[model samples]
Target chain A: MAFEIHLDNFTGPLDLLLHLIKTNEMDIYDIQMVEITEQYLTVVEQMKQLDLEIAGEFLLMAATLIHIKSRMLLPVSDEPVEEEDEDPRAELVRRLLEYQRYKQAAEALEALPQLERDVFVSRFVPTEIADSADETVSLGVFQLAEAYYRILSEVPAEVFHEVIREPLSVAQYVQLVVRQLADGQRHSFRRLVAAWPSRAELVVTFLAMLELVKMRLVEIDQVADYGDIWLKLRVAQGELAAVDLAEDGFGYG
Target chain B: MADLKRLAEAFIFAAEAPLSFERLCLLLERSRPEVRPLMQELLTEYSAGQRGFYLAEVAGGYQFRTDPDCGIWLRKLSKERPLRFSQAALETLAIIAYRQPMTRAEVEYLRGVDSGGVMKTLLEKNLLKIIGKKDVPGRPLMYGTSRQFLELFGLRSLEDLPTLKEVSALDPELAEAVPLEPESDN
Candidate 1:
């Protein structure tokens, strides 16, 4: 496009009208027909010359403007074509006014305080596992688990395809991890993830860790300023229950 | 059968994004106390076997997702549609996505142009959000990329962004037209 139009305030004819009003400081009800029409035409001409992909909204505004300009030029225009009829610019102004209000409202709404919304701290939490081994590092199981789950929410709705297959389970590795933890009270999360053979094993291992976290049967901790997260068998009351990997579904990947 | 496990599975399977325990609870009309444990137990049983897919939480929700190793294959599968966005939108979005909690003024200041309408349009498309008010004289609305931006862009985090050179190479002309500053890649 010759005129780098980035789908700005004029996604629709309505938004363009609002922008003209706000930027040019013209009152909606009393739009200076000659000047307003020229500015609107400038945008349309720009779009046309640049071969910008104009949305229908912009076209609709152009047609409305031409009609208003023609009406403004009609003989005895002040004779009042229809006393009860809408002013030629009324519909456009109405759209402009409403859009302006909401545009401001949207800005205002954003001005209010937000809760739980994240502003990226711009600090990277160095992956502890990466410290020991730095290669084609796939995302952590938890991160992948998350990325997989929201498959469609961020993607367009039309892209959604139904899945009829059953979910794969990591029962074997889950059992193995349980066993390893049974003998020892603690183990490195890095070691566990690294031990997995395939992507499936890695997922299963993470799932086991998640299950333990949920059941409160174990606690995975990354001490402040510490690197790797450690998984320790959960303690009950005042006593740490001796881990029993053989009884639970824990095994190697 | 409406069994709790099946319900959870269906929710996970049918979801377009992760379904957190709270979301599952809200969707199922079950108490969190009951559903949380059910999720745990089901998660435990599901993990006790080998499978390509696993249940995990991300974006503050939970859903069934394929294993990480499958990302390459998954990317291939998703590449079919080959999502497209206008260059100006992407440049404007890149600035907002990574360097957010920022205002329209700041965005324009960095990009050196009028983003008034571009910001508005992005907000309309739900690709960006008005996160909060900046502590300035006007308290302009701060902007950030939305979750929908993530889904469409296929970015797991801001860090998922390609190296500046690589991303710039995708459309060198546009990159030259609107070269982004590397300051905010922090």
Candidate 2:
């Protein structure tokens, strides 16, 4: 409580608590809730006085400590402590321990001979452009999902009172995607889903595209981070017909 | 064997990325068993600490890197950007690295802080990647450490990180209980 804590010293409430415990030389398992809570509140008060905006998590932990402190002040229940009546501090302690593990792990990571930071690798610049053939990397499922969500957001929200529309199947979308790439040119994933009229149809088309990628019929590539994802046919044009578009027992319903 | 060792050393030196054992085998047209000793020879020779650079095993592959002691001299030659991580970013990374394929909500819960900005920064830095979508109702994207993460940490693999006790073991009842719905996604 006597020591001044800089606002920038702690990342969060738990981080502050750990520092307090260490500075106070208190056992983590046997934390004196009353004393620790007072110190924590003092720090929080100091943070408040300085006009440093306290995150909700810090306030939440403050409230938790006060609540636990009050519980610690209550009269001892003679009835007996059982599993159902575990210590209030148990949960907090568990969380603190968990956070401590990760914090230590993070420190261990920092201490490693990190590339670019601790060790330097020779920059191997290939003078010939041909030596560095592929500038693009394969796109991940989440990247595609992010693209789909962006496209979905642009589509008008599904009207509650829906009109009867023809059912769209993944099978049909599969053929559509195949035909789009039949020319053996790179097709934009966004353009493929951009035309779908309904969310349901778009989802089906998206699933179809995913299926194609899974089957190795199509490959998704992004030239740069946050760039447009392009889908190219993996098989030759003549071999496209030999590929099957059979629905593998999944219902769109 | 001598020619193979020379080729392996040259290839690793010239390669932009860390050259994996499998790739090295393919390049040398040798079986894994045959290539094992070739890589070992290079690893041993450079590991004596006499050379300016050492063959480092990182990100599950080998790359020629200047020794840490040489970093002072190397800094003068080129001014490559040094990687820096805020405590929050490192904590977030540690949580994800330990509990991978995790949703953002889980990460936030563990850190007890809103992690959207940190997660975004990690993703932008290519330290974290979206592996897939969680199957739960909201279909939140699941995140995992990327190859660059391992490379940056000089980790041979995720298993090489310091060992941690299983989280679920901290509370038996918590482990058995159904996962509560993730806090409404930010």
Candidate 3:
């Protein structure tokens, strides 16, 4: 009770209790209830005085200790103890034992050769390519969804008014995105979505961009999180043929 | 034997990930009994050599890894982030690893704290996985250590884990818990 206790020294109440028992060098099977309970309460009180955010489980353990202490104080009959009548400290001792087992196991685990610290695996490093080769920027789907949500919020409230007579297809949006990117021009996704008059049109255009990327006709690039997504025309041989064919006679109303 | 050792070393070195004995055997067109000793010979050869790398059996497989003595230099050169685990996370993970098919409530009971946040972090890191649901009253989800756990800790399998008794010998409180005979009562 006289010693200082840092909250960080122990993971939780059980860890603190185990530390107390070990430091005292008391036999766990025959833990001195009155002494242990008093020490336990003092520690909890000290934690409270320090304004530490003691978790509810700690208080619950304190209450259980107090309950066990009070139970031990009750007068016993002159008759010999029955088999069913167990020691008050049995459950607490069992829990402490179980927790101690795991604490040691954790220490053993920590002693193992951890990856990247005690061991290093081989990492495949791609050979440097010439600047002439195309570089594809990959965006995580989560980031793509976040950018799409931002665009969705920017759509004017009035766009929801008219029930669209015809829902624009993904193919139509794909063609629309291709036309916008004609002549090897790069366009920000926001700018492309802004050009559409209705939310339906914006959504379709977004889908079209996804399709283009999937088909290798276009690539989506972002420099950082929440950054502007850039759409570039993929100039691969197969995509070149498709772009040329689309340019020949494709027109959108 | 030297030729086989060289072949095994090349296969393990060129592998993108840890290669299991079965995989190596299949690749070499040799049985387990034949390939295992050759791989072991390769393991000893690498460790005894002045090479910067060593062969390790981890994640139920064998792989070539940089020598731990060169870890600092390799980390500096590669700029690979170190995997960090808080004390609480380690405790929770240890319990799960030793006692798989355990529910969240069981973990909380053992730790005597809310392990939900730590469990979530472990799940996100792929260190812990929800194997199934416990057939209890509410049917809470059961969690187990992922294969990534073994890889991270350099353990070949659950059998490779240090026994509770062995660990307990290091701590007085833990040593006291080990019963001379198994208890039949729950």
Clashing pairs in 3: none
Looking at candidate 3, what TM-score does chain B attain?
0.80
Q: What fnat does each of the candidate structures reach?
A: 0.00, 0.51, 0.52
Place model 2 in a CAPRI quality band. incorrect
User: B83-134, model 3: which lDDT tens digit per residue?
Assistant: 7778899999999999997899999999998999999888877788777788
Model 3, residue B179: what's the lDDT?
24
Residue-level lDDT tens digits of model 1 in B61-179? 55555554544455544324433344345557766765677788776644434577777777766677666788889887788877656544434455654433312012222223332
Per residue, candidate 3 scores C-alpha lDDT tens digits across A89-164 of: 9988888888878887888898887888877887563444323335333343333555798998998766456664
DockQ of each two-chain model: 0.01, 0.21, 0.23
Error of 1 at A1 (Å): 30
lDDT for model 3? 0.78
Q: Give stretches of model 1 more than 4 Å off.
A: A1-253, B41-53, B65-80, B85-91, B112-121, B132-139, B150-186
Write the residue-wise lDDT of candidate 2 on B149-174 in tens digits.
88887788999887865543232332
Q: Rank the candidates by TM-score, best first.
A: 2, 3, 1
